[model samples]
Structure formats: structure tokens, C-alpha cells
Target: MMTMPSAPQLAVQASVKRADEILVVDDTPASLQLLADLLTEAGYVVRVAPEGAMALHSALARPPELILLDVRMPGMDGYELCRRLKAAPQTCNVPVIFLSALRETTDKLRGFTLGAVDYIGKPYQAEEVLARVRTHIDLHRLKTRLAEEVEQRTEELRLSSEELEEKRAQLQALMGFMHQVREDERTSIARELHDELGQSLTALRIELSWLRKHCAPLGEVVLERADAGYALVEQTVQSLRRISEGLRPGMLDVLGLCAALEHLVSQFAERTGVSCSFSADADDYRLPENGAITVFRLVQEALTNVARHAEASQVSVRLAQEKNSLHLCVSDNGRGFASAQPRQGFGLLGMRERVLLLGGEITIDGKNGTHIDVRLPLVKGE
Candidate 1:
């Protein structure tokens, strides 16, 4: 009757059949031949080296799947050779096993400390050698696979992050172009309203007055209707002026950022009755035209939010210049929301996009009151 090989024996048989190479380093010819023949008959390709230097040379030339080293060799012993093998980058990952007659626990411990995968006592058993060799080769292969997988994952994450950043940049550029288009449209519409509709209303009001003066004979009822028509025309002209200014303030183009912000704050105060104060570091210092327009729009949106949502009575707007940057702050003592709560409206989002387009930052804090702080670089087209 024939006995079946155990699981470990089976694994060794399977691995050896694949022709995995094993390096044997021993000083004694008898022991070296014994290990070599035993491994060869078991179906592994075996190579023998007389001492540590020859073993290291053979291993470096073409690293084996496993190394069986004699601990008692003269000069460079197994421990020293193991250290050298581990230090060299190419052979560092190869599994090493120590062979020795030393039964002391310290001797075995020293081998393990020097990175040997296993230590076998000599007079060695053939089966034990084959089993340990098989176990370690499997572990080394698994470790290599895992390392490769990790490296692949890291590279994938790096690429994904770069792609996301590029998309974000593209979105910001689109927003900036749209913002410019909208500003140009507003300027055109405002000009049309002021120059075309405003003039027509004014001329009609003058004609109504002339008609009333020339036709007093029409009596009190006709005179009263004519006066009513004149008043209505005057009211329409005022509305058109207000709407045009709101669309694109002509003062912003003529007077620059500081004057425009002052006018905006004054109007907000007068309209909302929300005690507002405006201040600036210098009246003469101004940003480029586009930057000034963005800042003015930022302040305008902030004040609108405060009036509509904050329900606060006191508001303060401040502008300052520092080195190459312009800083603007808008704060209100109103019914503030939680800082963690998300802003649901497009106003804050638009303000943030506008600031970012110019390579700036905006932060909104809603603690005791809502506070918006913005920093913009003064560089052209930044």
C-alpha cells in the first residue's frame, strides 16, 4: 500500500515540479552535495556555492527563489551573509533559511533577527527542507502580488485627483466668461433705457405741458386730466432712471470703485433704513476696471442678502488695500444662521465664483451676525 503525501508535502511537490531554483551555500562538500542531490531529485533546480562570497555572487547574478545557507562558514558566516543580502536592493526580498548544528535558542533567534525566514538543524531532514521552502516561496509570491496592487492603486488615485483639479479649473473659467457676458449685456441695456426711453418720456412730459397751456379753453376737467398725464410721465421717467442705475451704475464707470461703493452703501441705507456705514483706507487707491466692478458687485450682493435675510439694523462695509491685494468686508448685526448650515441661494455662490475667478478667496461667517470677508489680488486678469 502506498501512503499519500500530507498537505505540506503536496505543496512542496507541486512547487518543485515548477522548477523553482534553490541556492545552497555550505563549506563542507558532503553536506552541500547531500542537499543538492535531494533537492534535484525532488524536481527543483539546485545551485551550490562553497562560501558566503560565492553564494552572494551567484544570488546577485540571478536571485534564486530561496537560499539555504550554512551558519558555520569561515570569515563571512550565514548571519553576515544574510545581512549583506538584505542590504542589497536586488536580492533583499529573496527568502533565506539557515542550516546549522547549533541547538541553542540564541543561535536560532539570531538567524531570525537577521531576516532569515527559517532555520533548520543539521543533520537535516529532506522532507522538512522541502516543506519550509514551499511555504516561504508561497508567502513571498503573495507579498509581491500585494505590493504591486498597492502601487497600482496609488497611481490611480493620483491620476483621479489631477483630473478632478482640471475639471474644477475649467468650471471656474466658464463662470468668469459668463459673468463678463452678463455685465456687457447689462451695460448695453442700461444705455438703451437711459438714452432711448428716458428721452422719450421727458419729451412727452414737455408736450403735455405745452398742450395744457395752449388749450385752457377746454375747461377745468380737461386741464385736470392733462396735469394727471404730465405727472404720470414724470413718474415713469424716475422709475426708468432707477432701473437703469440698478442694472449698471454709470457712476461706477466714471468715479471708480471707492465712490461707487459709497454710493451703493448710501442707497442701501436709505432704502432699507438699515443704519449702514462705509469706509475705505484711501479714496484715491483703486483696482483695475474689471476688479473694481467685481468688488462693487460683491458688496452689492452681500448687502442685498443682509437686507433680505439678516433682518439686522446695523451694517458696515469696509475696503482696504494691502501690498498687492484688496480686502473688502461686509458685516451685519442681524438674525444670523448657523455656520454649519449651507447657504441655499445662488447669491453667495455667485459671489464666491466671482472672487475665485480673480484668484481670490471669500469666507462667510454667520456667528453673532453674518460677516463676509473677501481678498482679491490687484493683478490684471488675475
Candidate 2:
């Protein structure tokens, strides 16, 4: 399965990884081979599928870093095929581009809404297509590598737990260590985004701003188009800001966990109209920065799920005290998950790691209403 992480929950790690392969699915063998050769020349490992059925089968065998699909195919057309590819958890993040003859606006929108990054029409320029494909494929690969490394370390720690005298204690310590590591990673990424991507995007926006002014003497239409480009650069800057914030909420570090939760809940309520309620008996108790931020992000992701996928009416976040530990409960009045579904998601798994770092136990109840309960050790004598 493709190890794709959520965009809102984009992982923070040492260095962003890059995609290694691209899957081109076209019924026409000639076209598929052409695209494959182009990508290979551009330093990408290319995989080809002659038909939609073969594409689906190949995707299942080993998901690609990105997919270039044809919209018009005899059977299992690109749109339908892309939908199925996206529906699979293993291939959801694999960027899909409808490299087809259809050029209508609606068709483009449908492709994008299905998570395709850039739609390329048939008889395309090879360079432009290669550029975008390279960009997305690299991004996907980076995230995949980071996740794989984290999972590997996690499994190694798990193996060591078998040798410990007290497995629970050992596991708790391991969880704490992992959460701290993850938090550190997020903090590092936030710094990098703000310092590198954020600064570069802003600088690009400024350059575009200069271009608009310099081109003003040329013609009104020229100036107008320059202005339009400037706006897009600014939009990209804002997108990076949001991405940085989601990685590590500036407020969680600038503000406390309680304040962060209050902000998050209010934001959720405003956006989702879900009436999110947050309470804290944590006035005097303070979690270590790592613990506090982890819990805050945990609640943030849970509420986001409620907003995006829960179809919940109301949600509650409670932070109470247990003996020597803090008890956090996030409950929602919503359609809960089916028991048979896989118990895996980067967000939930991250939360568990955070709680584990604090020597805590996490209980998730995906029954009638979704409930995530976490118990983490508190500051002594709290």
C-alpha cells in the first residue's frame, strides 16, 4: 500500500523525501511508452500500464509515487479508474494527472477534486509535464521515506519491549520517546517551512510584485496579467503558512495547551458548525511542552476528523485529572467508525505515540460515538 500521510497532518522530519517512481496508465501502448521514456529521461523510475484494469492491478501490487492517467479509455476510463485508485488507502496520496484529450473545465475540476494535482492535456509539451510530475513525485517520496523511517524505529522499539521486565512501563517509555521525537520533528519542520519555504515564497511574491510595476509601462493587459501572477504567488505563500501552522500550531508553543485547545475548538465550531465544547481542569497542571503540544494536536486532529469525516453534530474535549496522570477525553456525537475497518491512520497513530511518550495508555472507542481517551503522567504531586 502507498504510505501516504494527510496533507493537513503533513509530517515533519529531518529532510523531505522524494518520490522514486511514476505510474503511467494509458490504453495506447505507444502513448504509455512515450510518457514512460520522458519520465525516465527526467530521472524517474517509470511503470507502465496498458489498460485501466492492468493499471489497477499494478497499482495494487506496488503503488506508484504518482500516476499519469488517460481520461478516455475503452473500459475503466481514467475518471472511474482514478476514483478507485484514490479510494484505496494505500494509493490515496499518489498524485494522479489525467493526461488525456478532454480539456473541458468541468473535466479538469473533477480530476482535481479527485486529488489530481495538475491535469495535462494530450499532445503535451514534455518539459512542462516532466517538471510538475517531478515536483509531486518527489514530495510524495519524501513523505513516504519519513514515515517509513519512523515506523521502522517504532518497530525496533517494540521488539525491544519484549525483553523488558515490565512491558507496560517499557512501552510507555518508548511511546514518550517517540512522541518527543515526533514533536521535535514537527518543531524542526515548522522552523524550516517558515525560514526556507516561507521566506522563499514571500520573496517570490515580492519579485512578482516588482514585475507587475516594471511591466506597467508595457500595456494595461500586460500589467494586469503580471498582477494576476503576483496574486498567485501570494496565494502560494499563504498556503505554505497554513501548512506550517498545521504542522506545529504556533499557538501551542506561543500559548499553552488550554489556550490552544480553546482556539482549535472555536475554529472547528466556526468552520464545521459542530458546536465543539472544550473544558479543562488543567489550570494549575502543566504538561511538559512536548506532552502539551502532542495532546493539543491530538485534539486538533480528532476534531478535524469530526469536521471532515465524522458528520458529527457536537463534540466535546475534556481534560481532567487522574491519580498522577492527566485524563483527556475527546467525544463526539456522530456516526462512528465501523469496527472492521483498519485501526491505522497517521494522525491517530501520532496521537498514540505522543501519549506513549508520556507513559500513558490510550483507549479508543469507535462504537456508537467516537471517543478517544488518553491518560498521561502528570507533573509530580499535581
Candidate 3:
């Protein structure tokens, strides 16, 4: 009874069959027969061609796994045939081993120049021929496999890079939307504080002043209490204004980005005693609403960071326009941290996001204290 072959037996059979195909081209019938018999006995499926033309026709018809080409053939020589074979895309990768009587260095170099993988002398041993043929075939197969793997890996890397970029863009859009929402909320709250709460506090202060003026003659304790109440109301109003401005400065919307940035620098100097100097070359320049807000917020955040972390005595903020781009730089003589260190706070990240959303670039340098440089394209009508 016949039995089915095992998995290992089947694999070995397939490998042998896959590696058996070879083409032998020679002008001499005896030499062709000898090479064919040697390869066929060693389990290779060999095809014999009398000349270079026949070899080319056979290869183009059905490309063999390997070709043993003989030089000094009639009509077209082996070198010319090898060059032609290599030039053709279909048979360019097939390994060619030259079997020739010429053992000179020039002859070998000519064969190699024509893309031959190996050269054998005229009195070639069957074992040497078989060994060389096996070596080259294995090498060709390895080279082909490596090329396939490299192509696959390159494609995979390209796809991965595309996916990563897509994800980054999505994240950026999400962050921009969140920032807008936050700003809107801040604006709403600031308006409520400035209009409603501020007015209420002002009314309360007026009523207390009237009470102090009229009811002060009633008693010293009553007058003192009235004065204290008026003072507390005044402090509340001042605190409310400060809180509202901190949340979302009305100056930013009313006075535009440049004025808002100047105000910010002035406030920072006043509050932190940092001796900040702000200079702008394009004082009349204006930006789109979003761009203005982005610039204002970036300056605000940077100044806040400087106040909180930088133990600097002086800070310089400069704004200029060159050609079609706007440039802003903030530098401080602070005890700066390592710029290469991973940023830990949301301040720098938020600033970066804001700049990126505006199609701008920002760079931070800590080599000479902390320097933040921002470049933004000055869009027309903005």
C-alpha cells in the first residue's frame, strides 16, 4: 500500500525540485553533453544549447534558475550574450557561471564585466563545476530573498511613517479645538466678572460710602465699621478685576496683539520687578483674530513662566517683521535649565501647540539663559 509523504519529506522534495533547473550553453556537442550529464546525474534538470542565440531564446522562453555559459561560441560570444541577458529585465538576476578555456586575468575580468558570477577553466573537474554551480545558485537565491525582505521592510516603514503623521495631525487638531474651547470659556467668565460682579461690587461700594457719610455721625464704632466695609468692597473689586484680566485680558481683544503684548510685559515688570523691555518694529501691524490671540497667549504664558521659575533681573521681548514673516523673541538672564531635558510643564507645550496651529515655528534655547524665538508667516489681510 502507498503512504503519504511526511511534512519534512515533502519540504525536502519541493526544495530539490525548485533548485534543479539549469541551462548549459556550449558550441561543442561533446562538452555540452558532458556538462548536461554531470548536472543531470546530480539531480539537476539541465537544458543544453549549442550556441549563444539558442541559449538566449531558451532563457527568454522560460528562464532557468541558473546558466552555465561557454565563451568563444560561433556568431554571438558568451560575453555578449551574458551582457544581453543581464540587460533584459526578465533574466537580469539569473546567475551566470562562465565555462571557458581562457584562464587569463583579462578574460576573467571580461566575463565578470559581462555579469558572470564565476569562471571555470577548460579542463574543469565535474566536482569543481558542481560545487561552484551550487555555491552561486545558493548565493543568487540568498540575494533575491534579501532584496525582497528589504523592499518589504522599506514599504512597511513608509506606511508606519504615514500613519504616525496622520495621528500627529489628528492630535494637533484636537488640541487646537480644546484650546479654542478653553479660551471661549475664559472669555465668558471674564465678561461675567467684569460686567455683572464688577458692577455689583461698585454699587455696594457706593452705597457704603453713602452710609459712611450720612451714618458716621451716629457713633465712632458705626463709622469705623462703615469705613472697613468700604475698604473691603474696594479690595474685592480690585481683586475681581485682576482675576478677570488674568483669566482672559480684555486688552487682548480690544487693543490687538501688539498692545496686549506690551501691556503683558509692563504688568510682568511691575509684578515681578523683572525690568522687562519690549520693543516692536511693526507697531501698526495687525493679525487675524485667532493669530492675535495665539501670539498674545504665547507671550502671556512665556512671561508667566519667567515670573514663576526664572530668577532673572532683566527680560527682553522683541517683535519684528521681515519680508512676509513676523518674528518674536523673548530672552531673559535667568538661571536657565537644560533645554535638552524633557519639558515637564504644559506652558511650553501649550505655546508650541499655539504656534504650530498658526503654521508657525518656535524654538527654545537655554544656552544663553532662556530664549524663546517664534516665527510666523504674515498672511495677507491678516
Candidate 4:
């Protein structure tokens, strides 16, 4: 026997079959009614919004998968609506289709930038509307499914990556121990070469001199050549000094981090006429070795980018410590860009990765000027 279906059961089945909710936003009642009838007939649950304000409210209330937006509404037109919608976290993922009378490329680009899925002009054909709506619904479904899969895969990958990193860190610590031992061995060898072998060579030279005095009438040319040979030995000793310095900078050992940074800035400013200026209130005694180098490299990259892209005559770099966070800011008076635009290049991307590695954040923007801000936290063990 066939039992009649319950109202809730039927509703659930209806919802399962129809996964798309389309919002038709138009000011004209006639246009709204026409689009509503067409979409309703095409197996879609349609809601009509007479104005942009009503549309935004209704969209938040219902959260449509696809929005058919009109360009020329009374208050808060479609372009600005799209912009605000894209900015909001809840509505950013919702695909928008601009149905407008405006036919300019600039208008289309503006709509696209504001996260519009498609732009349909006025006097849209019935088949065209049906086809476009169907295409967008399918596209929206695909995107939603893809996002879910990506998120799931990302979570799994994150767990796997964390395990892998733990293993890598263990190996790195072992390798670090080995490296320290190797460095100690090298230091001992260097001392031996300079102390024992060097002393032996000096003694041999003195004995040669004594032999030269005993064996009289040694040619002047031979003595001059012997002096040149001694000069060569002195140059070899100088080369050894340079090699020792390369293993570890003596400036870092003797002058401290601030002096090293000042020397770096001096060299950077001398090469580029960007008039780089720095300000610090403290001795930067809080930052560890890695933290100090990170700050220095951050400024270095910012200035390098300025020299290449900023084309400005002057630049300013500042570093200050406040509480647990250290702030670094670099600004240049070049042609600024619209901060609202999506990122296009990778210079900032690399910098962001570097900051994130140290559990910090970096911001690169072109408002009044190209501004870069990096904030690094001084953790207990950091």
C-alpha cells in the first residue's frame, strides 16, 4: 500500500531537487514581475527586490546563490552594491550577475572587479536569460563543491605537513649539532695553521737570512727577489684572515647588531640615492639574533623594491618596539595604487611568507604612498 507523503517530507524533497535561490533586483515593478515569472517557470524559487537597499537586506536574510542585479537603482546603484557585497565575508562568495543598461567596457570591468559572475545587458532574451541562469547555477554548485573539497583536502594536507615538519625539525636539530662540531674542528685547524705552521715558516725564513749573511756576496737581484717572495707570504696570511672573517663576521661579534644594521643601511643608501632614513628609540636589545636579521632583511627588500618601482627621490624606514611587538615601516612617495584591487604580483607574496614563517604579519599597500609594515612578536624563547 502507498502511504501519502507528509508536508515536511515533500518540502525536503523539493529543496533537495532545487539547490539554487536567485534574487532578481530591479527598480521597475514591470521588469521585476517579468523576470520573476520567467525564473519561476524555469524551476527556480525567485524573490523580487524593488531597490538596492531592499536587495541587500533581502540578500542577507535569504542569501541567494545567484543575484540578478540592476545597474541603475535609485539609492545605492549596482556597482557600489557589488563592491560592498564582495567586501563582506558572508556575501563575497555569492556570484553576482549584472543586468544593466550600461554597455561600456569600463562598467563591465568594474562589475567584474566587484566579483560579478556575468554582465547581462538590458532587453535580455528569454532563452538567453534561461541559459545564463542555468549556467550560473551549475557554476555556483561546482564552485561550492570544489571549495568544500579544497577545504577538506587542505585540512588533511595540513595535518600531514605538520607531521612532516616535526620530523624535519628533529633532523635539522641533529644536523645543527653536527654542524657545530664541524665548525669547532675548523676553528682548531685554523688556529694550528696560524700558530704552529706559521711559526715554523717564520723560523725557516730567519735561518735562511742567517745562511745568507754567512754566505757573503749573495747577488742584489737575488735579495730583491727574496724580499718579493716574503711579500707573497704576507699576502697569503692576509687571505687567511679574510677566510676566517667569512666564517663569521667580526663586526657582528665586536660591534653588536645595531652597528651591523647601521653599516648595512649606510652601504644601501650610498649605492642608491633614495635618501634612506632610520629611527630607533632603544638599543634593540630585546630582539634575538634571528629576529634582528629578519627585521634588517625586511627593510632591505622594501628599499630594493622602492629603488626599482617607487621612482621616488626620498624614502623613510622606521623601527620601534612597543610591548611584545616590534614594528617596522617603510614608506615612499611614489605613485600610489588603489588598495581595493586584488593582488597581481608576488613581491609582497614572498615578503608575507617570510613574515608568516616567524609568526608575524606583513602589510604592503599603496595608499598615499607605497607603505610596508611588518610586525614581529618577541616570544619567550624566540
Candidate number that wins on TM-score, 2 or 4: 2
- CA shift of 42, model 2, Å: 94
TM-score of every prediction relative to native:
0.84, 0.48, 0.92, 0.41
> What is the C-alpha RMSD, rounded to one decimal, of candidate 1?
5.2
The clash tally of candidate 3 reads 0
Give lDDT tens digits, candidate 4, residues 23-86: 8888888888888767766667677788888888888766887899999989999988888788
User: Per-residue lDDT of 1-382 in model 1, one digit per residue for the tens?
Assistant: 1123457655665666332888999988888878876776676767789888988998998988889999989879989999999999989999999989986899999999999999999787889998988899889888888999999999999999999999999998899889999999999999999999988998999999997897689898889999899989989988898899889999988987789889999989999999999999988454554788898889999998988899999999998887888889999999888999958589989999998888888899999999999998875443
lDDT of 2 by residue, 1-382 (tens): 1223334223322123344667888888678767766666566666787778989988988887788899888888988888998899888877887898899999999998887888988789988898888777667768878999999999988888765648767767776676667767988998999999888888888888888879978999999999888888888887787778777888776766788788888877886778889998766465654677767778887887787777889899999988788888999978888766835888777677666666689988879889999888877752
Enumerate residue pairs that collide in model 1: none
Candidate 2, overall lDDT? 0.79
Cα lDDT of model 3 by residue, 81-132, tens digit: 9999999998999999999999999999999988888999989899999999
Worst 10 residues of 2 by lDDT: 8-17
RMSD of candidate 3 to the truth, in angstroms, is 4.9
Candidate 3 lDDT at 287 equals: 56
Q: Please, what is the whole-model Cα lDDT of each candidate in the order they appear? A: 0.87, 0.79, 0.86, 0.73
lDDT of 3: 0.86
Q: Pick the candidate with the highest TM-score.
A: 3
